[model samples]
Target: MKSLVSSEIVEPYAQALMSVAKTHNLADRFGDEVRALVSALEGSADLSQFLANPFIKVADKKAVLQRIVGDESHPFLRNFLMLLVDKGRILFIEGIGKQYLALLRELNQTVLAEVVSAVELNDAQKESVKQRVQNITGARSVDLQTTIDPDLIGGVIIKVGSQIIDASLRGQLRRIGVRLAA
Candidate 1:
């Protein structure tokens, strides 16, 4: 969790790996490999012990990791694991995996736009809404991820990055509530 909190430190490494993965047409594979590796590290007590056992050599740890994850593991994962072994951040493998996946998702032409509303959108409505997001973000295309929250009352909230377009009746009610409470 500490490593996750230090995400700013990992972004550049993740981005560089993502760039190489994209260049090799292996982004999806690399992401999957990282996920699998993290899962293994989390699920196996033996692996964790072996990784952090100070008495064990780093070369031994690398060999064990290779055997477990296999030669088929993505180059990014291999390089990342080796780096952790070198720098003694093997404990943060999960953090690196997560950061890499996040970077990969962002680098792909995919942007997660959460459109919250009082009701679900029909197919046509969803497509049109996603198109609008793409237009605003200047992304190649927008893959619209939808959420229906009845509490929103009326109107829509469009969120991309740190920006949000909230035009909801519930939001207005909240403003009214705040004003009255004040």
Candidate 2:
């Protein structure tokens, strides 16, 4: 699904990033780097403030990013960050990360299925569940985001994209238990 980020504003940057990523075959890599940068910015109030500083030159901010995230960050990521800093739009890095993921999901035709269970599934079991989801969704591929929630009581609550399949005992019990309690 398209994100809330305006394509008119983001397309230019996304196109630029996409070209560089295609050249390096690192679209996903660049996205990961963007995410890391976003995390770093969010984790440090001082750093975020520094980036958002109106007086800071774009070159200086770029230098700061290079110093922090290091040279391994893809060139596109470096430029993208610098561009935002230059334009005084640094605060939107978090939104950019979210938009980047949305773009990645679109390009890959992949959807995230959140699997919340009472306990962690073994690797094999997780793969099995993924396969089942693929079969049901008719999606050639699926990305599973798994989490362990002890309060689930049992079974799994499969979130197929934006929808949820809450079969957890806590959920069912809440429905029936409510009837009984009433």
Query: What lDDT, from 0 to 1, does candidate 2 have?
Result: 0.76
Instruction: Write model 2 residue lDDT over 72-102, tens digit each, in one string.
Output: 8766677777777777666566666666765
For residues 1-182, write the lDDT of model 1, one tens digit per residue. Answer: 76565675566667767778888899889977887877787788888888878788989988988887898887666877788788876765666677786676677766778799899888987898788888888887665557889888787888987989787898888889999999
Error (Å) of candidate 2 at residue 134 is 1.3
Worst 10 residues of 2 by lDDT: 1-10
Give lDDT per model, in order.
0.78, 0.76
Candidate 1: stretches off by over 4 Å: 1-5, 109-182
List TM-scores for all candidates, in order: 0.53, 0.71
